[model samples]
Target: MQEHSHLDVGDADPPPGTARPGGRTARNREAVLDAALGLLAEHGYAATCVQDIATRSGVAASTIYRRWGNRDGVILDLAGTLVAEPVGALPDTGDLERDLTLLGRVILDVMSNPRDGVVQSTLVAAGVHSPTARRTLAQIINRRVEDTKIIAERAVERGDVPADTDAGKVINTLAAPIYHRWYILGEEPTDDELAGFARVAAHAARDALLT
Candidate 1:
């Protein structure tokens, strides 16, 4: 898979409050992330540890620690990597409703993937107690927010939404309920239902409520 341009943070310990960065004393970043995901898949997040990932990836325990700070950080990074589509990558169909429906599809892709859902929910539940994980998750979210805002900006240009529409709120309004149903209600919505969500969000945007 192609790495995102935003992730090329060189081989340094990424600054806190930044996007996912490559880090290591050697070429072990991918190895470590792969091992972490495999172990997470097999044993779940709570049961997996940094040492297990170190052993599985054949990187040193100290290196993993210095690179990611903890197991939660590793899990968060993996979650970011697994997003099927970056918010910015969602296609612009020249219509707000259609664009948002496509956004719903992206959300559906993540919600339907067991691995992706587990990793996301795990971080949401566990990152609160870990500074590193929390910070990394924030960086991930900030990146997505920046990406999604572009959609709203385009909508504004087309007069589909008001110029002052808050893109973050618009996206949150569009995405929150779908994710709520997934993580909170333990429900998997059909494509039609997902499209409904997009329609609702589109209506709200057109009505200037999400501004």
Candidate 2:
């Protein structure tokens, strides 16, 4: 069975010298990405190749190479797309706990999708010894940190969190457990587990900010 998976708003174009599709090229490129994702899901990163992607995408192997330098390039492009357009924004329910719960749910929804397994695997592989993968992961991490900062700032404005709180730290504490479970322990958090983490994280952040 093909592994299930999951992109970006403006600036949808791939890097320069790659595929610049207008009509047919666009369609074909999209097909290629879709196929690549499917193969990644089914075969994992190491097993996937240009030939496999080409066959799945119905594009020529040369075309795949011309667009994406190699498998790593394609995977990096996919990761970039995933981060550029996150699934949703952080909740702003005014209640910090409630907001965290909602955010946890959103994260769980994304991670639990079978398609995301490919990403998870790719990231794990990259962690071992791929500078390119490291760079891509770092970009995503930085973006997420910025996003958490925004959430913390919003909380401060609403008087839900203290003004002196280090938003980055708070976010790290909240996110660390989930990532550890998924990437390190090989355990995927269920919705219930995510909610629990959210609760604990919210409470901890609140205490740090307010107390």
Candidate 3:
């Protein structure tokens, strides 16, 4: 496979070579990450190289290796930063159904994004071939699970869901279908489809656990 060139970071020049230490470091890191993400999206994992990332980021290959170790390290860092941003906090509209519908919409919006799709595809491929990749991906997802647990706990506290509701299952059900459709079947979930999943999932949880 031929290696692709790095992403152009546009004409916005980095600060002069002698600028403040903190700002320069931040800019370089962001540039590297942005370029890496772009390249990963464009070329997938196999064709991307450290030299490409450095060229795309306008940094030195030595600098990238020093900073991120290797290609896997760069991707791990990217996944960490990307997943760290919390999606909007779980909705609490006083109605469990309505709140879940909102959550479904948010999830649909996230999964349908092309950038997210690229990241998912790269990670999935990596997980199949690299133990480190699999573990890193697991960590990223575990954090998301923790976030969902908090939402589930809040729902129980508000009497929107039963205390014994399997929060993990509830959360997984909401996302699994969409993920399957997108990543497994290569089909994006429609808004109506997402709404239906949310409705059915919420109803099942209610009937089974909430009496």
Candidate 4:
């Protein structure tokens, strides 16, 4: 029988190199992170605990606490979960409207998927009090924003958008509603709704409304 015991994770920082340990240590780390992500997707943030992760991973609860310190460290350490990609990137379609619509669809897919949703939700949950979580999430968003710069630059070059239009602003505007509905309102929007928002952002950009 699995223990439904709540977490006993410490608030201290985990040991250095916890994710890169050697031999069986590495194996335990891998097992623990995998279990954490699976459980988080299945049960959500409030329902999951270190005991649950340990039971699922076949690792000891105490060992998990020692290695990760808390749920924050565990979720934030999950493999490739938070790895960022170039945001706002669409194939060169020679049309800003089409590119942004595609970008919005991509964001919608990520937020709507069960596994990906949980990974992001878990990060947001952990970011509340965890510096590591906050930093990691910020870094991922920053990278995405940086990557999207090319899209804005191209739009400027084509004169489809205002000169020196801010890429970060455009992507953020498009993403704001989707994220709000998902995380704040606890609702998943329809594909049409997601695409609509992206389309609106693109329209706004071309009309210089986002300026």
Candidate 5:
């Protein structure tokens, strides 16, 4: 998301007579990323390759290589885009339960989407072989945590939670069960279950009852 600004390198600034650097670079990125995502959705991770993406997107493999470094980089960027949430902009309904439920639903919606789910599953498969994929996934999770941390901070400021409350823990607790259901158990949770998850997590955080 906006959590990793460094990963979102836009087009370069214009120097002399050149048009916007982002014009072609940005177009190429969009095309390549779209192609990659479509392939991941249709054929899955292992079957998709740079050459296939290049052919589908009408871009060069060298360009994709130069821009993204490898397939892992491309998938990482795709994952980031799929799950991009604005930093520090979590829902504020003045009630911790509603806010946490909103956050949990957002997470579930993102992870359970068809394309996003395929991307995540592919990343997990890649992680078995590539240390870089594993690290990138961890960084993505950290970024998500950072983005959601503001919710807990606001709850603390509103006297809903302790100043020493662990934001990461709270967020992770809210997310873990949903993630387990989808990613580990390969089960799709109903809306009521998602709402219950949010309510429990918020209640736990509010009472400081969770260890």
Candidate 6:
């Protein structure tokens, strides 16, 4: 397992000699990022190397070096891409229970998917010690929390939750137990357990306890 560093997005650009090539260059860049993500999912950050990524991506080592500067650079870019992909996009079902249940299902699906789950775990492990990685993870999580806040806001509009509820905080609280189970206790929630969690969160929100 790769050692983790807490991350923060830094202001560093690709080093002095880098080129911003377009056209096929863009394609290569995408390929490289995909390759990096795949490797990170499989081998983790410490084990993943730039040369291996170049081989998997079919991009030249020189290109990766020129484009990203280093292995951490590639991983950071990969983290950005991974985190930007939306999760838990709930439908406007009008019923809060159904919507929240759907959201819980989505969360469970993503957290349990082999590829996504491994990639997430690997990234967090990398983030433990790396400030850049830590920042990247924080940014990704913040985006997710913001996205989840939409659900709370909608619930409020529908009179399913308190108007004064702090959406972000509520969402985070709702997710806390799930994350604790997975990350800390190394366990997955069963279907019933997942549903129960969602119910509790929804009721808590409805009762104005999530303020």
> lDDT of each structure?
0.71, 0.70, 0.71, 0.70, 0.75, 0.72
Per-candidate Cα RMSD to the true structure, in Å, reads: 5.3, 3.4, 6.3, 6.2, 5.4, 5.8
TM-score: model 6 vs. ground truth: 0.80
Q: Write the per-residue lDDT of candidate 1 for residues 1-211, one digit (tens) a residue.
A: 2121222213444456644444343347767777776676577777899999999888999978986788876776676564433543676889888887788777677655555555666776676787766666566666666677777779999987888888887777778888788867888877788788888888888888976
Locate the minimum summed-lDDT window of 10 residues in model 3. Answer: 1-10
Model 4 per-residue lDDT tens digits across residues 154-200: 88898889996777888787878877887789887776887788788
Candidate 5 per-residue C-alpha lDDT over 48-128 given as tens digits, one digit per residue, 9 for 90 to 100 = 899988998899999889778777778887776644645435788988778888888777776756665667678777878
Please report the TM-score between candidate 2 and the true structure: 0.80
lDDT for 40 in candidate 1 is 65
Clashing pairs in 5: none
Give all TM-scores, in the order shown: 0.76, 0.80, 0.77, 0.76, 0.78, 0.80
Error of 3 at 23 (Å): 5.8
Return the clash pairs for model 3, or none. Answer: none
- For TM-score, candidate 1 versus 2, the one ahead is 2
User: Considering TM-score, where higher is better, how would the candidates rank from best to worst?
Assistant: 6, 2, 5, 3, 4, 1
The residue pairs in collision within model 4 are none
Best by lDDT: 5
Model 6 lDDT, full chain set: 0.72
* Residue 64 shift from truth in candidate 4, angstroms: 1.5
lDDT of 6 by residue, 20-91 (tens): 644465567667777776777667667889999999889999989987899888877766765766664465
Deviation in Å, model 1, residue 68 alpha carbon: 4.9
